[model samples]
Target chain A: MSLHKKILIVILVASAGAFLWMEQQQNNFTSGTDGQSASLPHPGHSAPDFTLEQLSGEGLVQLSEAAGNANGAVVYFWTSWCPFCSASMEAVENAHRVHGETIHLIGVNVTSQDSKQAAENFLKKHSITFPNVMDQDGAVADMYYVPPVPAVFFVDSGGTITSRKTGAVTTGELEQEISRLKEAD
Target chain B: MTEPFITWSVGPFTISAQMLFIFIAAAAGYGVMSLYLKKLHVENRGEILGTFLTSLIICAVIYKLWPFILDPQLLISPGNLLYFAGGPYAVYVSAGVAVIYFFLQSIRKKWSHHSLDSFMAAITTALIVFSLGVKNYGLPSPFSFGYMYEGVMYHAVNFYYSWLFLLVLLAALILVPSSKKYARSITMLTGLVIAYGLAAPFQV
Candidate 1:
């Protein structure tokens, strides 16, 4: 066969393999309903678990422990200096106020970039009540891949990151994610 | 799973994975085309370079102007033009415009089938690299090859495209010396269409 013919055969075989694999997987899932649920896509991967001191100086808060307690956790990384973070704080605070009981909303202050006092003051001035953790070394921020301020990671009950958003988010967006988080179980 | 992609900020510019991929694709395309030209003893480097630049300019213009077209008020503030991302629509529009431009240029230059073949090979290579970089895997799939996003495994549609394109490109490159006038080009084009059709169901 010509080189062209061989290449075409390769493509065909690969495509056919994909189709067959998909079909076989589908059949396996259909045969065992529990298997389907067990194999359900674990989207977004597990959220990087971390421990940080609460900004209120109320001892260290471990992410896994907090996540275990709540239906879902919202890990928000922010710096006091960011105007966008300032703007989004109100929406986050609102979400906390409304869904604090069910959702574990933790503010991770990227303190290495900003002064701890500034972050504390920013929270106080905004009248935010949700627990705020100070990532003094920015380790947690780095782990979460938050370069820009106002990054939010919505983690499900299983500690899987259900969704994430970079930059500022609106009240609606926050609530929408919260609802999705509630249902992510 | 943490930060699957990273964007580097250099001065006022932020280079994302997508942008880097596009650059890589363009470079690869240029190199592949150059190689083909050399192989074919074609000396129309200047014309080919012109066509590439023209396509790039057209793409940029279309991307920037797309938002303004959608929201006419955006035209009032020139700086706002920079902020309005054209997204996929801009890419499609730019590609459409570029194709028309290329056709016109091809006719005007009385280009050979060799030129077209080289152009197709470059594009296919570029596309393969770009797709791999972008990681635009489509809907959730049960297949193990699927990419996991947010706890769900999605069909690696981009990977499929890249793989198929690579095969076609390799075939074309290898068969170029076999006196197969336009056969490789036709095969490549046909393969692209078939691949598109096949991948449609898997796409989101």
Candidate 2:
């Protein structure tokens, strides 16, 4: 009828379309998920405990089932292909050199053979002394529903994921997020 | 199989603050529309809708460009480029263009009331678009707040329900009339925008 009325109708219709578009795409699972939104949502109420065959530098080790660990576990997502991830591990290596027995620093390689070997060599090459796990099927990656490579999930002593990082994280920021989560512990 | 929607927690709160912002925007827009069109003799509903759509574009551009103008660094940083440009800056640029267009119309000394109505319409559209965009980033889906990255950025079609709710509210605001001792529509609009600003889009 009137000009304003016409615009109102258009606005109404556009919003309806946007809504419908959202409803129809509910069944897909790609790289990202609603459960792990970028803006720092919780790691869900329950943290799933998964034990995977980890190819440790010394030998093959089963992570989450590894006995004799004292406090907590740090599961990092990385691939040998990513330079930044390798660089970050150097810092982790340095941290390991300083506090190897005190804390656990485990790197999980995302579905790459070159990176898996490169990661192993990077540790040996850089003298990265901590244990690194190989994620062949991307099972662990799928479990976290991680957004990207180099995702780090910090789990507390009790097993709940205290904090996680999606993109490349600095050693300092990594340390800070871990410490922040420990405040509640 | 469809992924599950889990509860998002930020700070000490559970409910998204983004929802509050969209509501605030709609509330302000509706308030403004109510005041302007109460007794004014207009052509029909289409003209009003067209005017508001133009205004929405204006507001979105204003909101988008302000940050870039204020701080050049945001546009410069490599990673910030895509999302930053898409977010508030886009809204501002669109608004800037709309403003120039409207001003030119005014200079021609055309139907001033008609032009003003069109301006408001543009703003309403921009607000809706910008709100929905922010929500999709998986920060918080206030309107068409598609939850991205809590899972994956779907190349195919995926949707959200909050958008419907937002539209309904917006529709109600537009179709409903105001009566007795009501503040000027423009005043209400300004107040609502200001309140939404307090919600702080960057806070999350």
TM-score of chain B in each prediction? 0.84, 0.35
Best by lDDT: 1
Model 1, B54-137: lDDT tens digits are 776787788657656755664565655444445324578877888678767877898777777877888898988887777654
Question: Which CAPRI tier for candidate 1?
Answer: incorrect
**Residue A24's lDDT in candidate 1:** 69
Model 2 vs. true fold: TM: 0.43
**Candidate 1 regions with alpha-carbon error over 4 angstroms:** A1-185, B1-5, B136-157, B174-182, B199-204
Q: Write the per-residue lDDT of candidate 2 for residues A1-185, one digit (tens) a residue.
A: 67887897887566556434533343232224544433232342324555555656355644444322535667777776655465456556765565456456777777544456666666676676567767787766767654245667776555556665554454454556455544644
Per-residue lDDT for A28-77 in model 1, tens only?
A: 75466542221221235556778899999999888777877888898888
Best by TM-score: 1
Chain B TM-score (model 1 vs. true structure) = 0.84
Alpha-carbon lDDT, every model: 0.73, 0.49
Q: How close is candidate 1 at the interface, in terms of C-alpha RMSD after superposing the true interface residues?
A: 6.5
Candidate 2 CAPRI level: incorrect
